[model samples]
Target chain A: MPDKSLRMRRAGGDGLVTRPVMLAIAGDSAAGKTTMTRGLVEALGPDRCVSLCTDDYHRYDREERKELPFTALHPDCNHLDIMEQHLQLLATGNPVLKPVYDHATGELVRPELVEPAEFVIVEGLFPLWSKLSRACFDVTVFLDPPEEIRRGWKVARDTSKRGYTQEKVLAELERREEESAAYIRPQRQNADLVVRFAPIEGRDDPAGTSLSASLMMRPTIDHPDLTDVLQSGLSRAMHLKLERDPDGRPVETLHVHGYVPREESLGVEKAIWSALGAPDTETPECLGRLGDARSEPLAIAQLLLLYHLTDAAR
Target chain B: MPDKSLRMRRAGGDGLVTRPVMLAIAGDSAAGKTTMTRGLVEALGPDRCVSLCTDDYHRYDREERKELPFTALHPDCNHLDIMEQHLQLLATGNPVLKPVYDHATGELVRPELVEPAEFVIVEGLFPLWSKLSRACFDVTVFLDPPEEIRRGWKVARDTSKRGYTQEKVLAELERREEESAAYIRPQRQNADLVVRFAPIEGRDDPAGTSLSASLMMRPTIDHPDLTDVLQSGLSRAMHLKLERDPDGRPVETLHVHGYVPREESLGVEKAIWSALGAPDTETPECLGRLGDARSEPLAIAQLLLLYHLTDAAR
Candidate 1:
């Protein structure tokens, strides 16, 4: 393609447009994609930000997928074309009559209308799967938590919330591994940022400590200058280092430690917020919320995303 | 407002597109819109053509409309934006997740996917109601039957098929008259072909005779050359005359007589089909069907629409 921003401006038809900035958070099931998206949406508030799950585009309900040979992770098992079309419409500041797949009932329910706002956060398995859909996003991030940790998250969430038994969740995870490898993992290479949240390897942390976050910031877009903030005596909470990406390319990676003191994390958060030149006096309190608990690593990661979204709007 | 054909070609990327031709048959309720659209879809075959009713975009079901202040004919009472968006998608040879309205139960049911074929026929109210929507059609037609004939057809159809009593139908018709004039009838000004089916005024024809058709073909698009065909001694069945259109503009009107003998109508049909340059030796037998009865005028009107559709495809 053509430059999507230019196409979007032309599609506006001479009207004044603060065209919505689109963000895609793509990952496999229970990879913390929703967790990453929810904080950003909450911080921006519902009026300015709207989020949707691409899982709603599933061609087969949970029961229907059982009859099919392939899992829902495969592109063929979902209406990816319609998802791409809806993304294009949303990116161009249009409304969509979106399909809704009810995970609880394993059935396709009545669709609802989704109106795009200033920030459209789309998270699911296939938002970044296609070039057309990927083109619609101003920034794309992929969640890549380790398989072991992701399996644990899936089992806990499914059993506690979705009413699935641990055995059934484990079996479904086992069945989905092949498709996840073939389809989901490959999308990480296309992301502007690859985020992995996990406990530090080889460092035994006390129980109840949140997982640290490692964000691999690719050179696809101009990232915020964190050198000054990192140099301002905030190294205990977060630091940046040059690392090799999965594709063997060198990238700047920011690692936020979850075991850091709350005051130190607050100092780093204030530094990043001020660097963003945001008009608000303080950072949004809604960031990094995991139910009732707050995760410092998630808060910093969401702050980084907020910087990119606001920068693109400019 | 930009060139839609060019946009559609660009949207197709490198893929070769025999882009589906679009035809719009817009009219008030019981004004023969479905009858006109059905014949064209049948003649083209399901594999080559698909049809959808815009009334499916109704924002309220029959039961819900009773609680509203205005009738369903109002633009606010329908998702015209979504309808327009779907039309744009279809015109570009894309599939739409279309909403379905259950007219019998007066309920909004689950939506279905609609894939465009070689020909896409869109009928019902509001297809020609907006400039953006009207732009998506290759050929636009408005059914303009006389008020008396339309009311009679609505009463007959609603009572026999839709389970509406004659008194209820008449009361609803009376209530809808203002909106029909305000929202529905005004679309006639936008259609390329204004078609009216009724008995010729001041002529005493048998009660069982088919209603004659008066087709006012505007100069908006290139019409088929019928000079040679009309001059070939087929005047007994149909004749072309210069007439002033509703807006007081000169237009070429073709009047097909319903009382014409079957042999005379067949001769006219064959001539028109040959004029269309179709390779088939005979016209489709599905044309002009009216519940086990055939109408010669209906067949000729449908043939005229077929000409426009195929011409646009070329």
Candidate 2:
């Protein structure tokens, strides 16, 4: 009945009401959004975290999209207004009857009720597409894999999991390129962190080497102190360097090497975990799970996000 | 983005934007809630008005309720919080993805998008159950037909249309009596108008005579000026008198006679319709329809509600 802010105030027992911390993971299709979200949610545990995808707000089913002139990347192809409204409700610690879009059937299915937990993680292509939606997030992230790498990942995923031919997935990717440039990529400017996972630009990696992660942390919110971790003799695993963003602004970027030994990356993870001051002494094993294997770089990236979520809850 | 009040202010074209006028028709099952809503929505036309039943907010399907201790009339049996939120949205001219309850199969089905027009008519069991819900309505009406008459109507309708046995309907009504008293009837105190349709007390009418309507207009809203219409030499069709309410408070009541000739009641209808100051000169033909039959009292009652809706929109 009352506005959310007032409701939050009234819910305080010691006159210190705290709303849920909201995180946004925005990226193009097959850009590892689900992988990033899965690790964070697993680390936080299901009781403390809830996740949803904005693709549920698609305006048309897969069959209906075949008749439209535009792909799903365009804002006009989705119910962005309703998505914004639902985001506001979730951010305010309210439950929403969230729409469900079934990827397997390519159909719009029955809606399910989603109650927000202490940490709300929203991942999809359009989480940061608008100002109102962007305002709903406390920490926003944009996944920025290289175009060639992302395309390869998409083809492999579509063929293996989604029952699509490599040619069809590639053609769909080609068709979505214009709208991705016009709508999706521009959202990178609004994110608090831009994360890119790829092989080093000028270096050749072994066939089985995992991809490294480059994280650009903007000064929009107070970030965790990583000065001690950088000097902990883990330079082969991670290092901080000054870089220029696309907007020609100077930013501090953290690079975590995937070629480093797992034990070396574990040292870096421990340093960041101690900086978090989390109640748990050991890092959660659920972090960095990619199917049956694990990636140390993903574990560290997720740990940094966990640090922010815990910091804001404070 | 913004709260409804702020959104309304920013929506102004001439700096006087008005939100949609909301009307709540609350009553027990088979108390003619749908009949009353049908007349009003038909009179206003589909382009300018939209109507939804709060029964759609039921938390359980009909099959599930058989196992629950309470009937659908209980507040706990419905998603009242979400219903309150949706009412707030519709009252502010915002669209909602409303849940659907299929009465035929007694199932909770897919949700449908509802965009409010100039007027929103909300009808069903618990629309007026809570103070917060009552506050969303510009005009509220509670239908209070006599118990015997309502039971008869329920039996006839359920048997003929819903494929229910008259014996089963009677048994169900008996089972629901306690909850109807505990949760439904008390909402009458919050309505702006309490309407009862039955034969006049201590009088015998012809075998086929229609039921008359007695409207108790509360002082919560400024009702239209009916002084001239009451004195327009139509006493046989309609008249106003002072009476004490169930709470022993003095109130003005309008009594419309169903036994009056059709031409005489039409004169009263014309008087009320003209008093609305509407641009249309002729009365709408769709009002007061009971399937293939019609009632003049139902027409006059609907016209009075239309007056309130138009007045609030101003």
Among all candidates shown, the one with the greatest DockQ: 1
Go through the candidates in order and give the clash count of each: 0, 0
Off by over 4 Å in 1: A1-16, A204-206, A231-237, B1-16, B163-167, B227-237
Clashing pairs in 1: none
Model 2 TM-score is 0.90
The CAPRI class of candidate 1 is: acceptable
Indicate the worst ten consecutive residues by lDDT in candidate 2 chain A.
A8-17
Q: Tens digit of lDDT per residue, candidate 2, span B1-314?
A: 23422432343311322468889999999999999899888888899999999999888988899999999898999988788878866765678888888877788876778888999999999999776677678899999999999999999888887778999899899999999999999999888999999887644274677888888898888877776767867565678878989898777788877776778777777777777776368887888888898887788788778888888777
Q: What DockQ number belongs to candidate 1?
A: 0.35
| Model 2 pairs in collision | none
Q: Quote the B-chain TM-score, candidate 1.
A: 0.92
State the C-alpha lDDT per candidate: 0.84, 0.82
Q: What's the i-RMS of each model?
A: 9.2, 8.2
- Give per-residue CA lDDT, model 1, range B110-213, as digits (tens): 67889999999999999998766776788999999999989999999999988889999999998888999999999999999999998876552758778888
